[model samples]
Target: MEDFEILDFLELQQEQQGIDKTARFLQKQIQNGFKISIVIKKQHKFALAPLQQKKNDLFSKQHQPMDVTSQSSEQTENNDKQGSSTSSHSSVKMNKKLIIPPTQNETPEQNNNEQKSEKSDDDQISLYSKKNCSFEHLLKDNLLSQKIQTGLSFMKDGNQKMALEKMMDAYREGNEKLKQCQDQQQISVLIIICIQSLCYASQLLMDFGQFSESQKCLDKCLNQFEINDFDLKCKIYITKAQCNLLNNQYLQCLDNYNKALIQYEQINWRLEVAKLLVKISFVYALLNDFTDAKKICYEGLQILQSKLSHTDPRIYDTYYTLGCIYYLEKDYDFALEYLNQSKEGFIKLYGEQHLSIIRILNLQGVINHLQGNSIDAMELYEQIVCLYGDSQNIGLALVLNNLALVYLDRMKFKSAKLSFDKATAILKVYLNEQHPTFKRVEKNKKLFVAATLSYL
Candidate 1:
């Protein structure tokens, strides 16, 4: 028998008894020959045992059938030569075949299990890749894109509060996963859509009278992306203009609004031009330049009349500004007509409970008073007083004070005193005690007192 035959038999036995057990059995067989001793270093002991056992098993199994007397000496010499040749062959074969078992501690089944595990792992990775691609496709068509469109529609309809909430939810949902995705072009498009949605949401917040909240949202949107793009920079300035308007910083508001107007003009954005005209009119009104205010208001009206439908909110904004201008100029009849048109438009667009409607109601009362319809004026004032009873609002107080003045002019001193006192009490709470309006209210109180004394 040759060493190759012995090795083949030992491998068969190892398959039956497991690698570790077969190795120990063969190591004992090696110990019986010529008192061969092994001196294993502590670290090498585990590694050397299996190799030594395999060598011994090969020698014993191959030489067992040879002549034990005459051939023993000659066989020993030949065995040394065979060992060298066999080792050299094994070394060469090692490059092509991985036939050696891992160790005494490793089994044939373990190697099979390991190969199966590696194959399963690769299949799992492939499955995950397919799922990710499908998920991204679904998000692009069904989730993120649809959300962006819905949010934009809500913003356009002046349902800004709801639109902002939805836009922010969409932005957060897309941002984390979009960052990690491999589709660079798709991710870039999604990011641009999200930023645009957020910008619209911020604008809506400004429209809905949440100036600080709108500013914070704008800051977050700008922080998420580069603001250096011309279009995006224009939006940033427009948002800042809205904030300044709400903060009553009229000059800053005018400056930013003009900046936005210049950008819109250069880009030929007609709708944006109309919108900026409305904003500029607001600033002009605040500055008490009613001429400039009326000019801008008419510019917006012309744009809306030509481009937008009758029921559009931009038309209402234009009419509303015209009404405000006439009211400021004391043109009662024209003011009443424009304001009534504005009121109907707003009611159709946003319903009567909106704050914009409240302002219209107050303006209607002023127009009635200017038209000498005391009965109608009183009715409107009483309705507002009921609607916003004890509310701390400077505008409401001003309306109440104006209504009292109407009564005082008619020598209805008792009703005048009542309205005056109510307005004063509200103003005292809502305005600073040392405010200029407080002095005006004091003067009105003195007139009421004098009227009361004369009536008594």
Candidate 2:
């Protein structure tokens, strides 16, 4: 009987040890699988740390209070079900499903709750996708947006140089995603600002006689203007007209000017209408139709004189146009009178060194030379040369070339040869070989040189 009792106690101890070992093994497996699931879900929400923390808090609150006895009972029930439903060979299949670990033996309600938790995590991640990304990527996008904004600000304030620099940097560095976002947000204003800056840059290039570059800028500006920006469209058309005029595409320029004028008329933009009239007059002059040029000039003058004050900028343009018209018709006395009035008006509005003032001075010198006032013409020419400093400059070259004619007419053969040589050298450097001005200068130089030799 004693031996039997001892054997029974030994059997009980061994069975208890086996149960404890099985429970521990199952608990470890469940904990490991729970940890892996948490990690995988955490990775999906990498950008939303606050949401992950909330999930962890919810999990702790639900699971932390369970006692070991209840955990053990749950484990035992799961183990029984698993052992009955799965064979040793089916363990691999069971592992593949990644079902809730046997130690937990979750109910249907608990499974549904887990699914809801996962769905919530996915929804949260999708909602804050932009905020959750890598800090480096986020910071880079922010910097690019800030740069674009700065560029737009500079453009708004009329600082075109700085605006262009910043805008170009943003355009180069910005990613496709950022561009898409900007488009979706209707941030076309930034693009418009960049286009406007390019237009201003083109204007500066035109001033320096860079016609090809200026045309390219105008093309880009026109491409960027949408149907909604009627004002910008009208302005771009006007600019294209001016560029066409500069490139000697007279008919095309007139067509563009007419189109712009029609748009301005529709918009009731009188200032723009007046400006277009001046451009039309220029085209007429280029066509050598002095009658039409004078007619346009008088029409513009009537509108400006009646509607605008003497201090207005349009007044000077009107006076200058009248002077050019009279000069073209060989009315030298009236030309000089109108040109002097234009010059005084421009000097009052803009300083003496302004381009308008310089151009008027050049025209005045030509009119004086035509009127046989050689002394006055020579003095004006000398003043222009001194102000411009370089005979090769466009404004100065025009004056120098005209002054050479004055000397030739006076029969000052040596002085004429010297002036012709200077003008030819400047023209050769500044004007294209095929340019009319260049050919004229060459012809005049040859005549002056031949005259000088004959006189000698």
Candidate 3:
């Protein structure tokens, strides 16, 4: 429910007094998650022509906020004469959505306001093309989309090399076409194409484990676009964040996630914001910032509770995260409680044998083992071991390790070694000896040997 930037609107009157008043109003309205944007598409249709002319005179495109010395004050006043009548001397009001179309009578002016409302905040900056044809025009004018599409098709088919090549073709095309962009629309189309192709290629490169190359693609895309391109910038930050997440660079992931979170917050896109907050909380939990992690995680669930059903998979995920955090904190009681809730939710949503249940069962088993509830922990571990059904995986390895620990605690050395050996073999294949999971199992082996000797 935090207020965030939803739109950057074009105010027809940017007079010093008017801007001061507008800024003050915006400061107040922003508290409710509103921002200033009043686009009279029909009236401003002609109002934007000089922007193009200004471009022709000097710069390649208008500056962000796209300032142009517009039509005289008198003409602009006459255009909004209808609005000026009852809007109380340009007094601003705020609401969750609608900006209150002046005079609700069905004039084309009202329809224009309807169009503005129909637009998401991102569309507000398309000053020249009021028709919202940018996306359509994007499809039509984008020269390299075929290549980009082919790249994705190759990616879908699991052909990473070919996918990378086609994306390169699109990238080169974008590089060439962007330089040739003479107008705002042309450049806008090229920017989207560039970001789309580059972000896709960046993700593709991530799969290849060429992270530096992947990052270079996004860096180039970021450099190509200016700050005013909020949507495009947001996409790049998200892609960069994904790269960081995959590479386990938690701090960088938090930075990028927070950047996108700010943009989502501005629009008061509560669901997305909540989802990001939960993700951030997970990362914080990974960093052992349990205090903030638990706080943010609960806030996320609260937001979701208002929007989604109680049994929603997303809420279930939040529950699982909280469970994990509490487990890490060694608060087994709360950990089990949340894990049980998620386990039930997942079972109802995806059925008992679904892989989602494996996570809950595994964590719950670990919690039980930590609590010295060997019998309960053994049962949960055995259940998931059966559910794994011959799959060799990290989760299965960890569970087997836990099951062995439980067996060791119960003094069943024979059963313990059998479980421990299986875990050892899996970890040898999947993890380096120095890796934490492997190290844990290896360290346990030493203890197992000592206990065996003592038993002998």
Candidate 4:
């Protein structure tokens, strides 16, 4: 025990000598005014150093460096870590050096330059997103317009099936609620889609002679309509007017036309006014008021002559209306004269195959039949029927009714019944059993039955 204590005392004295030597060295350095400047060489710009680098920084100190054996072991451990950690961290910042503390000449705010650079990058990203979004919206609107145009072209070419498919594709999107829209642009898009869909659907229904369904679509369109859109408003009212005319609702037809006319005149649209005049005169002619009908027809013709050329469509429309009025008055010669004039004008404006001439051909056929020119009338009716094929065209159906009457007069009961059946089938697709056109065909069918019975 005594030998162990003497050895411990010798060890304690050696440790004290070492402590005194380090203190004496530090005091000499301070008295000589030593300035310690840490000049760090950098390889990467990062807020945090790698594990090996941190170890090197912590262990390597002034007047005492890590021994070579310890350094080699640390390097071996860092190599092992590199293989496992490189893949995990290679995606982060590896090209720029770490941000360091500010120097004596630098302001505190200068250290925040990295953060400001990051913020600017974020703003550029946001601006690019907004530009892309605006471009997409433009493409969306143009695509919509193109589809609507394609639908309109199909309608004009009389391809109802293709037209329906095109319209459905154009219409059935963007159904978000207008109230839920966050901006005026969103609300406008919804309103445009609604109006285009409803208007095209209603007009297509009207062309198919489905007046009730057409009216329903038109009613919905009115809810989305803007009051300042007089052109579209006039179109809707005219469609309504035509529906009433076909259904034999003369008073309602007049009311609809008057509504449209009021707006046209308010806008001082003379072209539309002149056209409406011709149509309104026919309504009067249908009521057997020949004097007022002729008066209105001439008034419209004079306005048209002043505004349009001799070959203008409105001029031909005026002539057709006059022919119709004179026909109702049983002035067959005058009716034929005006109808021939209108037919030639229309043939010049639209090609011979165009349906624009159908109404004129029909009037001429009726006049020929009344004048005992059954052959001419038969040719006219057959021509119109051939033009439309077997489509459910209301005009073609009416022509078939007139053709059947010609057959009845000539004692061709079988032919008359065939024509009557075709007309009835077409009208039934469009009109109810009680509609005037349907009833007309039904009433004529009795003649076919009676004649057949008498012959048998």
> What are the lDDT scores of the predictions, listed in order?
0.51, 0.49, 0.57, 0.54
lDDT winner: 3
Backbone clash tally (model 1):
0
CA RMSD per model (angstroms): 43.2, 41.2, 20.9, 46.7
| Higher-scoring candidate on lDDT, 1 or 4 | 4
Q: So what's the TM-score on candidate 1?
A: 0.45
Query: Distance (Å) between predicted and true CA of 377, model 4?
Result: 1.7
Question: Candidate 3, residues 67-141: lDDT per residue as tens digits?
Answer: 123211212111211111222121111221211112121122223122322333222112123325545566555
lDDT of 1 by residue, 129-210 (tens): 2124544455457476678668767655645556777778777776665556566445544454556556666655554445
Model 3: CA > 4 A from native = 1-250, 286-291, 427-436
- Candidate achieving higher TM-score, 1 or 3: 3
lDDT of 2 by residue, 249-334 (tens): 65667777777666555534444455666667755654555665765655555544544576776677677777776665567788
Candidates sorted by TM-score, best first: 4, 2, 3, 1
**Candidate 4 lDDT, 158-230, residue by residue in tens:** 6665776676676565333544555544444445555566667766665554667767766665653432344
User: What TM value does model 2 have?
Assistant: 0.54
RMSD in Å for model 3 = 20.9
**Regions of candidate 4 where Cα sits further than 4 Å from its true position:** 1-179, 207-213, 351-353, 389-392, 424-436
Which parts of model 1 have CA positions greater than 4 angstroms off?
Answer: 1-253, 282-295, 305-307, 350-355, 389-391, 410-414
Summing lDDT over every window of 10 consecutive residues in candidate 4, give the lowest-scoring window: 1-10
TM-score of 3: 0.52
Clash count, candidate 3: 3
lDDT of 2 at 137: 43
